[model samples]
Target chain A: MIPLIQAAIVAVFLGTWQMLSPALGLQFFFATPLAVFQSLWALMKSGLLFYHAGITSLEAVAGFLLGGTLGMGIGILLGRHQLLAKVLAPFLTAIYSLPKAALAPLFILWFGIGIDMKIFLAGSIVFFLVFLNTFHGVREVSHEQIAILRLMKANERHLLTKVIIPSAIVWVFAGLRLSVPYALIGAILGEIIAANRGLGFLISSAAGRFDTAGTFAALIAIMFLALVLNRAITFAEGRLMPWRAAEEGREVPI
Target chain B: MPGPTAPPSRKSSEALPLIEFRNVGKTFARGALEAVRDVNLSVAPGEFLTLVGPSGCGKSTLLNMTAGLFLPTTGEVRYAGAVVADINVRVGYMTQVDHLLPWRTLAGNIAVPLEIAGRPKREIAAEVERLMTLVGLTGFGASYPSQLSGGMRKRAALARLFAYDPETLLMDEPFAALDAQMRLVLQVELKRLCRLLGKTVLFVTHDVDEAVALGDRCIVFTSRPGRVRQAITVDLPGDRDLRVLRYDPAYLAQCGALWRLLTPPVEPAVAPQGRRE
Candidate 1:
């Protein structure tokens, strides 16, 4: 109730002051909420929103899946075998520290200004996020628990399925949830850098023509897509880890 | 009960010692610190052996060595006459803290070992339900570990250990975390289960009474680089009830003997604060 009331207060302020009232003679630059929504409606009616949004979503989701799986595999593999982690630690650190998105141009050079570029871009970003998280997850898995399973005469298959994977799922989901925004960022940014389609292109191209309303509309669409994806991951996480409810239920000090 | 020494002669007819630590010595910090040293012990088949030691005595370390979680630095640990080269699955381990997989319900926790063994689904379910009832968790099968009390969690852990019906049990203070009443209750239940299943057990704890009550033979350990101070063969009957055993003269005698060995008069004083030379 408090949040709803707070949101209403902000919405009323924005609607009245930013739209209803006259601006300080800056209409060309600052797109009002009303103008952004108007442009959004226009794009939706023209069916452009569906096409661009669809392309971005496809690139983001596919990249997310590909990167997430690759990251998890590498993470767990390295995590389970510390020797591999030691050998690759410096390399991973250096790569991870670099601005991965800066490589978008290089990827464009290799993969061209097509969906492939955007997909690879998004995959690279999401891969590191999930890899680091899964690695930490595997590390945090209790040695005592592993010892217990081993004493039960569990084979390697049992260790992975019964102990390793289940233990790492929580961290994997955390990485997945955080990757939603990064996935969109990667896809949209890649699109803006070179592509002729996607929300990123829509915003960048519109800005070139000084279409502030169109830019705002594209930005809002990106936010909406991110929210939807994040909600999806959250829903899946809840379904997968009902046990976490106990830990979450305990009151945390603010 | 046959005397602990009589086991050597009876080995011809009975099963051999299920586990043996051959002059085991474990050093940590690349040999900088010794946790347990010069420890040689054996547990016969279906026998209950309790290890009593002071805090940080590395009694648990010895158990880990036998489980093949850690290799002895200077000697070898053997299970069923074979050197433990990897994780030994012939034993079921119960830690001092009940590591009930929080995600799983009580029944699901019990089903873990069986499920890992690739038992039939129906069999796992039946066995889980049966073990839950056996551990006095009959109707609490669906409840998660967090929902249960500490003692109940311990029982659930015990059931999970028993799920696979392993021939040997390597327990590291499994009841130490419980309350006094719960500990006694669990001791009785555990004794009954172990006897019925004919499982060999290597139980570790710091409590002398608990050691005497549950063990056929009790090995007392000195602290820090733990070595055997004495090995007292307990005289209590195998099937003795926890209540009666608590007051048994022989039980007290054995417990007292171990206590004397562990905490002799003129006990070592607290270490110097390193202030004055």
Candidate 2:
């Protein structure tokens, strides 16, 4: 029943947009749903959609993994080491607050408008989100839990793996979930600035030609990609922390 | 009717003191708050000693010092004839909160200590099962801490504490968070386990009845800047059921005595009528 309502909502929205396009002179700017579908069909047949979408997906995933790993590592390190964290805190905050789009052109200059540039831009954006969450997560772990493990003769490795990492996992996942869209945005922004391929290039190249339908097709593809990635993350979190799911399950019935 | 008191164990008194506090005092926040002061006490091996005091009177501080979580501000805490300067891994500490890893199942949480010791898979599994049964959590081994009741979680913590088989247990009101009926049940279970394992326990509580019911010797502390007011030997038989023991005349007398010891002295200026509010 919920799925039916959701599907009906989408149908009605598209139907209204398609019907009102000609009356409102929106066809040239927003494009009709039929026109956008036609544009998508054309791109699919020519395999341009797959080629560009593949490049964009690769950039986003690569950026997300590299950035997420580095963020988690640095966050854990800084969280554990007070002196190092204190010294580097100001610089990290400054970098974190900077508009990521402003860094795209600079990244392009550094990495020469290649896949490296897009990856670096997306990765840098992802790094801070994951890093901030993971750092706080590590810091916020119950000191009582740490003490318990210590008294149980837990060495540093055991504490990290068993207590610290597990305790901070929820925050890490929060960061990961939050950064997925930002990762795509960073990749697309880099491609818009200087790339010859990727979904961002498709959108920019279409807009340059005033092809509203083509631009909309690329955007719809990007939205779908974001949805898939977010779903994948949610799945991984559930797999990794089954106990957390059980906890929530216990709460709902009451 | 038996006498109100007998005597503390001669066996424990004869044994070498496993934990000793020499002129121990602790002040936190750069001497802004004094938690305990000029405390000198010792726990003999295999003795179940309870520290009874008002809240913020530094009962927990004494246990923390024994665990080597922090050092005393003025003096020292010694365990097994050596000054404890680091985390003492030989003692198991349980506080009011269970502190179970939320992501781990009961079996997994209980297996923590054994895992830390690098026990093999089969052994850890066997030990975890034994502990689960010991704590009456037999079939609930697969359950997470969040799935359990307050009493059940406490049992899981008790199982986890016993998994490593530490020689001494430092419990800071471990069952204080439970309901009255559950608290009594756990108290009996804890006493039984402590006796069965021959563990030397330093249990802290504000409950006068609890202090009298559990300990071989109960040490009463004055309210804040907690100093030992008296150390009373409970002298009760170890095997008595806690429910029956609660109504025993001797037990009631001990509890009454501990209550009086814990009551703060009235100030001269404060009117007696004003104290009611």
Candidate 3:
């Protein structure tokens, strides 16, 4: 029911946009939604859209995996050892809060205008989000729980894998959910700065040529991919944490 | 003619007290105030002992010292007559909160201590199954802590505690968060389990009735800067059911006595000073 209403609103927006484009005496730079769809169809026929999407998807996935894993590892370590957390916390927070996009020029200069630069940029953005969330998750574990485990004669390894890791899993997933969009954004921004391939490059090239329909086509493709990725994350979350879903439903009217 | 009552047996050599704290004193330097003063207590093997006191009485501080979670300021806490140098693995401490890991299922939570101890996979599986059954959580092994009710979570915590079979169990108001009926049922189950396992148990609670219902000996402590006020040994037959014991005259008397000891003395308020109009 909600989806139907949302679709109707989107259709109304597109209908109004198509109606106004011709009436306003807009230049060729402003394309109607039908023209954008036609451009998308042309790209699909040529298979260039698929090729560029594949590159962007690869960059996003690689960055997400690398960043999420490294973030979780360091976060858990910092969370467990107070001395380590205190020593590194300031530096980490400083790096995390810095405008990462401002460093795109530096990354491009270092890694060249290849997929590597895009991957690096995206990974950095995703990493900080995952790291902070994972660290907080580990810290949130109850002292009582640790005390109980200690009394059971559990060794250090046992404490980490069982208590620490399991406790932080939810937080890690939360970070992942928040960072998924960031992953796409980072990849696109990096590609926009300097790239020969990817949806970002397609949009940039199209805009430079004054092909408004082609630019809109690239954006539609990016939006579709983002939606797919978001749905995948939601599905994974539901499978991994049925209990959390049930608990949330009970607590809130929604 | 009536049958004679059985003679009390001497403390078995093998069943000697496992954990004992002699003149143990803990003082937290809260800027200036002393938190706990001199205290002494013993936990006999196979006996259920409860420390009952009002809030801020340092009852939890005392338990923490015994669990080796915190060190004493002046005196020593000994496990099996040896000074505790580090966190004692021979004791299991369950805090007032259930503390079940939200991410793990019932079996996963129960298997935590075993997992930490590096037990073999088969052994961990067996132990998890055994504990689930022991805690009456047979069908709910895959259920997460969030899916459990308050009483069930506490039971899961107990199963986690029992996973390693610690000789001495230190519980700090484990059921204090539960509803009255749930608390009563769990208390009864805990007493029965302690007797069966022959574990030395030191349970801390603020409830007088709970102390009398569960403990073989109840140790009463004073308010802040807590000190041992009295130790009362319950004279009821060991195997008697808690439900039935509530109706017994002797049990009522013991409960009444412990309740009186717990209630603070009344003091008259001083009259306010008046100023001239």
Candidate 4:
């Protein structure tokens, strides 16, 4: 009930601002909040909201999977082979240093104004983040534990499956949390640059036609999408790492 | 009788020590320092040896050589009269660090070796349950290491080693993190388990009481660039429990002497000539 009242207050304040915008001559640029909500309601009624949202969500999910898998694989590999990681460290850093947005034009040249461009762009951004995190996670695994396993005559496969991967998964989940928003941003940026569909395209096209309310509506939809994706990943992380929550109070005596 | 006992061994006490360190010298920091030097030692199969020392005395380094985790810089460590070259498979080890994989359930961590050894799924499950029960973790099979007490995690570590049932055990300060009562409980369990299994053990600790309570013989060590100071036989009665031996006059006397051996000698206070009465 408190939350609902707080929200109501925010809504009323915004509504008053919207009412005063025309009188204050701020309606042209400010995009009255009521107008934005009404436009969003219209898009929902017409089913256009889900259409653009579906396209953007699909692209983001595809990119996330592509980048996350490849990142994890190479991350674990590079993490396992320190020499290889050292050799490639500078080159990887140079590439990662450039803003992922700078790759937009190049991605467009290769994949054209389709989902492919956005997917690749998103995948690349997500990949580097996950890779770096997984690498650090693998390296941070206790050398003592590895020594203990070795004394048991544990082979490399045993070490990898039993210890290394499980430890690294914690970082992978962290990467997932950080990468989800970036994943959406990547997908939307590609659409904004050239795509015919997606929330980004909807917002760009609306802005071009001076429909500021429509632009606000699309932005709000994108925010909702990012929130949902982030929530899903958070759920997965909790399920995958049940031990972590228990660790803080780990030593309760019997 | 309530705990898992050691399997019967036909080898007699007169048989050669299963593990021997001959003139073993281990140098660390690129040979800047010798952690241990000319350490000559042997443990007959099924004999329990406790090594006690102050910090930085290389007691753990000595145990590591026997486990083949560290190769002696100057001399070789032998197992059953043969020099161990690589990580030795014949020994089960528990170190001071937390080794229980947090991701695995208690049962899963305990069954790691069996899985590595290619044991079948059904048998692995059964064996894990058995080991858990042996370590008094009967209902904790599904719990992760993070959910357990410090002592409980030690039990899980102990169970993991026992699952492999190696001929020898090398433990380095395994219960050093626990409170006094917990340490005693775990130490008693280790003693009971070692005696019943007839497993040869090279255990390392700084606590003299623990060394006396669990060891057949306690080896005292000197400070850095360590070497054996002296070896003291515990002489606690056979067929006895650690709790009983902990308070026994014989045990306390041995612990006292070993503590003296471990501590640096105190220099006599000198009186100033000007202040002489």
Candidate 4's docking class is medium
List per-prediction Cα lDDT, in the order shown.
0.83, 0.88, 0.81, 0.84
Candidate 3 TM-score over all chains jointly: 0.86
lDDT of 1: 0.83
Instruction: Give the alpha carbon lDDT tens digit for every residue of B1-277 in model 3.
Output: 1322322212323354566667777766652655567787766667778888767878888778888887888788888888886788788888777878777778888887787777999999998998788667789998877777777888888888878777778898887767776667777777766777666788898777788888878888766667777788877776768877778899899999887666543123321123111
lDDT at B47, model 4: 80
Per-residue lDDT of model 2, residues B1-277, tens digit only:
1222323343565777899999999999999999999999988877889998767889999999999999999889999999999999899998778899989999999999999999999999999998888767889988988898888898889889888878899998887767787677678877877777677899998778888899988988776788886788896787767888867999998888777665544344432232232
In model 2, the clashing pairs are none
Alpha carbon lDDT at A133, candidate 2: 98
DockQ of 4: 0.52
Candidate 3 lDDT for residue A249: 54
lDDT of 1 by residue, B66-138 (tens): 7778788988898888999888878778888888777777888888889888899999989888888776788
Q: Per model, how many backbone clashes are there?
A: 0, 0, 1, 2
Runs off by more than 4 Å, candidate 1: A12-23, A86-112, A250-254, B1-16, B30-32, B179-185, B241-243, B246-249, B252-277
lDDT of 2 at B218: 90
Residue A240 of model 2 has an lDDT of 97
Q: What share of the true interface contacts does each candidate keep?
A: 0.67, 0.96, 0.74, 0.70
Residue-wise C-alpha lDDT for candidate 4, range B220-269, written one tens digit per residue: 87666677767877777645577667568877788788766655522235
TM-score of each model, paired residue for residue: 0.87, 0.88, 0.86, 0.87
TM-score winner among the candidates?
A: 2
